[model samples]
Target: MAITIKHHIPGRVRFSLAVLKQYRDLEDWIKQSLIAIQGIKQVRVNSHAGSIAIEYDAQILTEETIKQRVAALDFEQGEAKETEHQYTRGDVAMNAIGTLAAVLLPSRWGAMTTATLIAPTLIEGVNELKDKRLSVEVLDAIAVGLSAWRGDYSTAMMTQSLISFGEYMEQRTSRNSDQLLAELMQPAETMVWKLNDNQSVQVHSSSLIEGDLIELKPGDAIPIDGTIIKGAALINQSALTGENVPVRREEDAVIYSGTSVHEGNILVRVDKVGSEATTAKIAQLIYDSLSSKSEIQQVTQDMANRRVKITLGIGAAVFALTQDVNRLASVFLVDYSCALKLSTPVTFKSIMYRAAQNGILLKGGSAIEKLGQIDTCVFDKTGTLTYGDMQVTDVVPLDGTNDARGLLAIAASVEEHSNHPLSQAIVNAAQDNQLPHIAHGEVEYIIAHGLKSTLNQHCLNMGSRHFLEEHENVDFSPFEAEIKALEQQGRHLIFIAHQKRLIGMIGLRDQLREDVVDTLSQLRASGIKQLIMISGDSQYKAQMLGDELALDKVYAQATPESKSRIIEQLKQAGHKVMFVGDGVNDAPALTQADVGIAMQNGTELARQAADVVLLKDQLYAVAEARTLANIAMKLINSNIKLTEYINSGIMLAAALGWLTPATSALLHNGTTIGILARSLAAKHAK
Candidate 1:
């Protein structure tokens, strides 16, 4: 094999198109061989790119030798493109052929054929023993060897065939998860419209470069991160923000990749291209998450490794005490290693898939387990508990008319065309109540205050209490107590006056999420003993909200760093804290908590820092996620328990001479299948 040297620097060489069709696993074989040569530091193979990058000590090995080693790599190809997951078509076909021959041939011929077929398994087992390790492969080889020694070649062949198939199934299940993520995040190939000299031209997205002016119409995905140069539109940023609503974007407003234009058209100047885009960074984060071990995964692997030595020791003792080959083989065949190793990863991936379907993105199995263990849950006030938008809560008429609805109608008409959240809330409320549109004369917006308009040639003034009392000089001494009561309830008031006299006051407040109270009650009922609310709002407002929601603790006017400190204090007090937030300011606190759950409408930084994301944008999803975690962990424990108990029972039966090598093998394989089926069938229980 010849390789093209793509680039060379001191102590490094990169080879392009380094893979061969006949030996897809050639890269691994090359890496294993080359790294053994005295000076190599690291070997990285990107099978997708068909390239290899190697770093070595220049002093110990010359560049020419490295190149020659890669080119002169010669060995019989045993398998095609071996990976942590490479049970290829060739391996499957070989197993099928071996099993057919063993089943159809005479005893002597079948024994010989089965022995030849299991040659690789035996060789791998020998290698494992030489390296001082007890592998499932070793146990499997022992079982097959014992059966063949007894002239039961058909049983040996069937056991070995089933073992290979089982391994292939486990590898396939694990790899499917990685593949699903890749597919979901994979970039689509399409043509983008570029604007040059105010003319539109279509070009492939790959051809798009930085600073290119691109035209986007409704329903087109934004291809680059940039500011809008012309036009205006509503952008659906669900892919980035995880929110379902379409946000309005005007000229000079920034837009990002993976977000789609919902309405109108715009010309945007690209600021970042390809992998530099924010969405690409998110994809990279997801890929990086796959390599990280969660606490449970780490503990499970460690326990399995320890169990291997114990199982091997017990098998040896059983053989010594029994002096029966079939009984000894049974002891070797049934063990906890296979079920422990395979079930954990498979269950984790199953939960991840289920979470995705429910609009929650759990980064890994570790997050799921941690979520289940959380005993204290902390929530951010604004945009987390409340809707983050103001809504009209009350209307009081004081101008002797006592018609609150008419006053509200007047206010809604005056602010109908405004873009402010407060104004939008008022309009939305009026529409919800089926209020008719009231026509008015040319409207005037007073900066930092209110609006002015004329209905039937009479002046209408609507604004703040300060704007009405000081600016318009309206007397409200009779209603001072009423005003004070609303203020104490954390209400925001907008005063409306007609012909320079007070007519009414519109009271608005941040509405809490419809299911927030129920969700909090559920969390408390689920053993989360401490429910705390942290916010940057004023102490008075925070207290009002706390009393309303019946929270156990409240921290008002807290900064991002202060929130982090609070989380630390909670941890020091022996609480496993889970923080729920949806802002950039909450990123630090989110990272500080034992588990960070970000809302769907949260900023990119917050979502990236969070271990779990509520893609459905509902707070109740938090409780649902926690419930799912509990179910998954319970299932894992059940699988481990059932496997150990069943294996123990079979070992006892074999010791009593009630089971032969063939029957023991059948029982062992059947138990493994049963455990896996139960783990896979696990689903979220309410």
Candidate 2:
């Protein structure tokens, strides 16, 4: 295959593979081949564009080397690697042709033709039996084989036709559900502004390397784990911290991949790229979760396998008692294998599809099963329960010179020059009141402290109380009583000083999510027995929020390790804990709990550790997910009962000679198809 290098950079290159335009199926093989090479981090194939993009470690492989490797690839070898298990139109067409042949040909010839069509199924059953396992395939083979031995070619052919079609449909449904989930987990390719030669140039994120300076503006997701080196920004770390509020990241502050800039601009020096990036690691974790099977899935499969053996014994007993081959064939045709084996997973897939549509990503059937069983709900206070953004709650003027609005306007004027969350909050409050900006001297930002400017020739200071009192020599003794009152109320105060005298204090607090009360109420109503809250806030603040929400218990000043310990203790004390958290600190607790539910804006690691991730930024989705799980489990159980009772009745009728081999086959297959339809229909169930 001829390869043309369309673009090239240090760690990345895009090649035009014109052959992909004609042979699109070879794309996966080509990607796999490149990924197998040493130093290659990622490969993306665009068949439509006939391009293959590769990101590799430049230290190990050069652009010239990658180009040579691509040119040397063999298209014929790639074609040979295609998956054999993939269903095609030919599979369905072959089954249809065999059924038509069985119906149109002479009896002996028709039997031979149908037998050839079912040979693979029989071989599969034999393989299972050789391994000491009786499966649905075994039951299916026996039913078709007995009918043929009784000289009923048409019945055998029809049964095999139905089995082939059902199996195909099951595969297609499973594949579609898995594809939907895979699509959801795929990361969107991003481009970032890199500072090359002091000029900003847009480049693909994959091409970034350590020490490269990348500029980020409002709404741009940070594509690499790095430290901000220039400027400041209010970064929305909800994706990493699960907090609704954006935090200020200034010079030297570490910023992680998956977080976004909410306001302002910053230049970050990349420290991690490609698969080593935080979001990429999370994506890998999510991919691993897709194949995991729940205990319920295993249990249902075991039950189905056991029923196959029981069905074979029933057929044996019926034949021995009556010495009737026809009756035995009828009994064999009525086995519970088909409905019992297929419906549980079908139901789980259906519910998963529905959950995804409703802004919830249930990792697998295991997540759904565990979520349904969760009794004690543990919540992290900061990001999970409270809104991420802080709101200005109190604006007090101490000098008796400025009203609340004047004090707010003055603070906003200076704060607007910085990108801190508190500064933004004050600025936003002033904007809401339509207050004009107070003209002041050039603002000076004191990192981790506050802001300083000149208003009417006297120095104006606005920041932490410690910054004003200890550093700026501003006396706050007169407002000690007022500050303590606000502190006791869980208010974060921003002190303002002019001419070394305390002038005002602005109080900001994280607002509780409006839906939190209703969400907690719904959780309790939906069988969550103990509602607990964990927080990094002071004991007084944590307890205050706990009381407001009526939480059963509150753990204050919790570290990441302590959070996990609390979850472990809860589980040890006989509770099925569902931990809801959003921060990097919450990752341990998220993993420790029986079920971890990550908020939509939660950190990448937290989401990866979580079983259920809410795609919508809503606290109520937790309750919705719990309800959906209960509904899914209920649907699966009901399906099991329906399969058992219906198949048992059909089997008894077959044994008593109430149904012929053909009729028994039709009824049994119809019952299986009906149960499958009911399971798939659960996607629409409330």
Candidate 3:
């Protein structure tokens, strides 16, 4: 297994800077490497002047290829003589200054080099978008600019621009913050493993770190990775593991350093320090997640455009009213979207992490956003809704064989080790009947089909209708009508046979979820327009379940891809849809929907793919989220209205000579805080 990098898919670019061994030595080499690809397998890695860079096409050059090429370089073999360049502090600062100069131009004015300097910065400070006072795009630009500004100031190149000592200090601090996050985001370290036939790992950590024997108090950051030497506590690791509530950790429970201690205090032995800590990776993921685009990217894009126009229009109107461009420029400092933008993604991620604590995994922000807009939910039933658990309900013997149990018994013995939930159920059912299970049979596993196995030298097979037909044995046309009658009532038919002889048929009924009917009704009552059921079960059983749940639409016998297609179909027809599923089988549909929701106890894949994960598997969680969203949007709209009313009224007063430009500037900035506070009121509403 190799991880495929999907960096060049239009809107995305993947870039990395090398982690220099003697990082302090070569700043210029790092800067030069930034312009091109940095070859790999480097051990005694020396840095460039300041940063390492990669060419755009490097994504196409897989890591494996680079590893091969870098291995061949043999840096020490040639007594390797290569020219090393040197630069003074002023030279480095001047070069960086030149780069930032070109990058200052707006998106429409720059070239590729400008993008290299600015793009990463834009990605870094994307959270500023939450400041509604500014446009999302303007925020992005400012973020990029701030980074460039910091870089220039750090190298002492910003002296020309900073007219005062105060400005220089501000520029320096901003640079420090930028560099801090960048240094902390070094690529994840990989570990090699050796295992015997047993699946368990002998030891987990590779190295040990010594720290002051500090007792971790409740609500404290772990500070180091360690095994539980003493004590226990419920750890609320929303910051690290994304769990809403704290998870309980007892003695002998290994606690990763950096995850917070939510409640109880404990003694832990430090295992790893610094970068190797789990908290570091969590922080990196948080940063990357903020940088990446969510599903409703339109909100940010539109906000960005609106800010630019609002600023332009406001600047003119303010100039006419107060006759002071300087005061007008001060209005530009208010970014009202900061709280809104940053909180949305952060809140969504927190929800995902909470879901993980409840045993669900939602892939990313995009999926979470999609889950919020859902109206019509589509589901893949067998594994998703139904527990995918099966049990033999009936045994129908055919072809004059009075021994149907014998064949089922033989088949179940061989399939005991199969991973399918259904197979496990069958084996358990056979054992319950005290049926003799003969082992030592060769079994063949088939995808999308039933398995074939030899029992006591007699060929036996079991699976779906198509698989049975392929074997050309077990011709059950005579009993087909009876089977259809049974299936109409929600019974599943599994054919068991021995080469050309129909031995018996096993009927299984997957138990319905205890709360499914109530869940569906609650969602519909919450204003969900359509409840569509997607299942691989027979049409008869599918319709039966739909009727039981009062679902408006039902798609029976669908594959995973088909579930996603159904979601797209509803969206195309102009309805917002939310899909609720509980297993990996529903991952595709979860990703495809407007809002994908998972039950509290859903599979990791389904949870990760969903936008909102239901904490308790109750449909009410969906209702809670819908109501929350409704209120959030309302607050957002109200904030805008208040801002507009205040600005327009203030401008009128300024124009009539009642207010000075300086006074207008102060009031305009002051009212922003008040408006935001009033907007926050809706956050607590029902």
Candidate 4:
């Protein structure tokens, strides 16, 4: 096979192979082979696109070496190497045709036809026995083989047909569910404009590197985290911060990947690129999580294995008691492996699909199971509970130089040039009130302190109170009582000065999300025993918000490390904790909690560590996930009971000769199919 290099960076490369489009079956074989090679960390093959993305250790194997290895691979050899044990629809259809032919043919021909149809099952059973395992395959083989040995050709063919069809359905359901999740988790590849030799060049995002200058125009998604070096734009950070409105980003402003440019254009110097980008890391985490099994899956698998042994033991007992091959054949037909092993994961996958449709991405079955059991829900204050965007709430003209609207207009006119959150809030407030702009001299931005300019031949300053009162020698003692009152209300005050005198102040605060109260109430109603909040804010502000939300506990002034400690403490106290957060600082806590849910606008690190990531900017998604998980668990348990009880009843009836081999096979397979249907339908339940 010839491979074409699609793109390459330091540690990652993508290749296109036209042969893969024709031979779709080669996808898994190629992926498996590439992943087994040294230094290859991950391989994603898209046969439809004829493309493969490989993330490797660049130090160990260069991109050139990987391409050479790919080119050396033989598709013919790979096709022969791929061996699948599961039955396909064509296999089941052929078996059904064979059963029909056995019944229509003469007795001698029917016996031969039955023997041929049952050969594969018998061989699989022998292989399992050689491997020292009494699997369901072995049970199936014994039942069909005994029926054939007893000269019951029709019964044997029918039994083989039922088993093959059941296996086909089970495999098909599992495969489809997995494919749905894969489609949902796959991230779209992006192309960006890189500045080359002072000219704009379009290239794959994978080819980008740190310090490369990338240009983003209106409606373009920022592909790499970087600092804006030129131009300006209204960037929508809703995907990262859950703020519905777009904010302006100017020169020297830091911009993160995953956010999009709502308007304007800017040149960003890439700080993180390729696999190091937050979105890329998150994509890797999601792929890794797909294969993880939950505790319920493990338990059901163990139960299925144990039941296979029990079925074999019962078959032996029935044969020894009456030396009746017919009874033994019927007894072996009722093994409880198919339903038990397949239904739990099907249910989990179904629920995961439901969660995804509702804007929640459940990483794996383990996340669903753990989320269902969480008793304590802990929330981070800033981005999780609040909108994470400051808005102007009060505008007090302290010196009577301007009314509220006039003070806001003066502040907005100067702050409009800045990209700070507070300045944006003031500008937005002024825009909302249709305030007229007040022209001023060239505004001097003093880094972290404030802004300075000449307004009407007088000095104007806007920044923190310390920047005015201490740095500029402005008098704020006269407004001490009024400032204290606003401070007590948990508002951030921005001091505005004219001619070196305190003129007015703007009080801004990050407002709580509109759905937060309803979300918290739903959490409490859904069996969350303790609703707690952790914040980096002062104790007073934290407690006030906690009280308003009726939370059980509040931990204020929490550091990143302290946040993890709190989760550890709650877990040690016998509570299953679930932490909801969206900042890079919340990564440790997200990892420490029993279940970590990242909001839609969460930082990449937070999303990488979280078990569940909400794709919508809604706090109620937490409660919705919990509800879905609870329903999934209930469905799984019921299916397990249905499988065990129904299979046991069928086996008893077969042992007592109340049912023939054909009838026993029909009932057992029907029960398995019914249980599987119930499991797959979990998304629709409640």
Clashes of each: 2, 10, 51, 1
What's the candidate order when arranged by decreasing TM-score? 4, 2, 1, 3
Q: Against the hidden reference, what TM-scores do the models get?
A: 0.65, 0.69, 0.54, 0.71
lDDT of 4 by residue, 1-686 (tens): 77889999999999999888776677556654565454666677777788989888887679987897778677776642333355777888888887887879988999877878789989988988999987788888887888788787877888788788767766565555544554454333466778999866678886888889988764456777899998888876654464645799899999877666655668899997543444432333333455568999999999999999899899889889989877888898887998898888778877887788788889889999999899999999877898766889999999876899988999998887554456768988999999998888866665445688888999999997667877899998899999889879888678999999899999989788999999988888888999999986667878888898888999986877899999999999999999999865676799899999988766544665688988898899999999898888888888888887889899999998898888988898778878888877775665
The lDDT, on a scale of 0 to 1, for candidate 3 is 0.52
Score candidate 3 by TM-score against the native.
0.54
Model 2's C-alpha root-mean-square deviation from the true structure amounts to 9.1
* Model 1, position 132: C-alpha lDDT score: 82
Who wins the TM-score comparison? 4
Worst 10 residues of 4 by lDDT: 278-287
TM-score of 4: 0.71
lDDT of 1 by residue, 260-292 (tens): 665566889899765445543344434444545
Whole-model lDDT values for every prediction: 0.74, 0.79, 0.52, 0.79
- Write model 3 residue lDDT over 1-686, tens digit each, in one string: 12233333322333323433234443332222221222221112234422222232333345444333333322222222232223234443543564465547443333444444445335433543555444533543552353334342221112111212222222233223223223322222222111224221223223324542335543344545667766787764444455544689988787764355545556666665543344333333434443456644446445635655665565567667777634344443333343233333433434444333443334445654554456776655664566656777877776665576766676677566444566767888888888986664556655345677775577878777767876445677777787787787688777777775667777888877676776666666656777788887778788998887777888987766778888888889999877777654566687777778776545443444566655454444555555455444444455555655666676556545565433544455456445544433332333
Give candidate 2 regions above 4 Å deviation. 1-101, 130-132, 188-212, 215-287, 394-480, 488-506
* CA deviation > 4 Å runs, candidate 4: 1-86, 109-117, 187-212, 215-287, 395-480, 490-506
